[model samples]
Target: MSETAARAGWVEITCEGELREVVGGPNRHAAHKTRTALHALDRAWLAHSPLCFIATSDGDGSCDVSPKGDPPGFVKVLDDTTLAIPDRPGNKRVDGFTNILRNPRVGLAFLLPGRGDTLRVNGRARIVRQAPFLDGMTVRGHRPALALVVEVEEVFHHCAKAFLRSGTWDPDTWAPQALPSRARIAKALDRPDDTLEFLEEYYGPGYAERLYG
Candidate 1:
C-alpha cells in the first residue's frame, strides 16, 4: 500500500499520558520491582543463563542487538552492581561494540533454555580489553581477548506471558522445516556466489566445532 493509505486511520500517541490511558498503569509490584543493584536471586539467575541479548545505540541513534552465549554461567558477576560478559568468536561485525564506543548505555535480556521468564538489566557499559577476572572466564581452553563490563542501573525479572503465549518452549509447537534451510537462505541472500553444497557443508555439524576457534 502507499504510505498515506497505510497510515490511514492510524492514531499516533504523542505523550505518556495518552499511552497510559490506553494501556492503563501497572500494579504496585510491577511499579516497584525495578532495583538498582542485583539481588541474590538476580545473581543466581545470571549464573544459570547461557545466552543474553544486548542492545546498544550509537551517538547518532543507530541501534544494534547482539546475542552472546556460552556454557551456563559464562557471564561473571563481579559484585552486586557489576557484570562482565566475555567476547567470543563471531562474524566480526562488532556492531554492538562500535555502538558502545559512541554510547556506553546498554540493555540486556538474559534467558535460560526451556524457561519462559527472563532477567532484564539496563546499565552503562565499558569495553574492558584486559582484566584479572578475564582469567576466570576461560572456556574450552580459549580465553576472551576482551569483555564488556556493565555498571548496574536497573535490574528486574520479566514475566513469561509473551513466551507462554507463543509456546516458545513447547516442543510440540516447533516447526524447524517451516522455512528454507540456513544454507539455502544464505545462498539466496548473502552468498549467491557460493554453491549450495559448499554453504551446507560450511554450516553443517562441523560448524559447532568452530565456536571458540
Candidate 2:
C-alpha cells in the first residue's frame, strides 16, 4: 500500500473539539499541582532516588534529555525551594550545561527502582563551578568539578500507570542486554581505529578509580 493510504486511518486533531474528543476534559487532579517548593513527600522521594532524567531546551527551541545517576541523595535538597546536582566526570559533552546557559528552564523526573511512583520537578537552573558547592558533592573523596543548582518552581508526584503498563519493576519482564559495541559504530561512521575494545584496554582496570573529577 502507498504510505499515504496506509496512514489514512490516522486523524489529525488540529481543532479544539477534535483534541478534546480524545482526552475528554481537563485533568481531575489539576488542582493538586504544587508550586514554589518541595513538599515533605517530594523531599523524601528526592532523598531516596539515585537517578533522574533532566530535560532542557536551547534558546532556539532545540531540546535534550540527559540521565544523571549517582548514589542516593546525590541530588542535594538544599531547602524547600532549592536543590543541587553534582556534575560527575564523563566524556564532557556538556550538552546539558550548554543548554542551561542558553535557557535556564529545566524539568527533572526522579525515579527509584522498584518504586512505581515518580517525582517530577520543574525549575530554573544554573551551572555552578565553585569550590564550596562542588566540594560538598564529593563521592569516594573525589569532588565533582561542577554542579547544577536548581531553583525549584514546582514539585509533584506522578502516578505509576506508565510504569505499571510497561512492567518496569517486574524482574520477569527484564531481559539480558548488552551495550552496543563501539567498534562497530566507529567502523560504520568511517573510523575503525577508535573501538570499544580499544577504549576498554586504554581505560584499564583502574577505570572506576578515575570516574570522579
Best by lDDT: 1
Mark the regions of model 1 whose C-alpha exceeds 4 Å error after superposition.
none
Model 1 RMSD, rounded to 1 decimal = 1.0
Worst 10 residues of 2 by lDDT: 176-185
Per residue, candidate 1 scores C-alpha lDDT tens digits across 46-149 of 99999999999999999999999999999999999999999998988999999999999999999999999999999999999989999999998999999999
The true-versus-predicted C-alpha distance at residue 2 of model 1, in Å, is 2.3
Q: What is candidate 2's CA lDDT for residue 166?
A: 96
**Root-mean-square deviation per candidate:** 1.0, 2.9
True-vs-predicted CA distance for residue 66, candidate 1, Å: 0.9
Question: Candidate 2: misplaced stretches above 4 Å?
Answer: 1-9, 15-17, 178-191, 199-209
Task: Put down candidate 2 lDDT per residue, 132-183, tens digits, no spaces.
Answer: 6676688888788788999998888888999999999998987644544444
How badly does each model clash, as a count of residue pairs?
0, 0
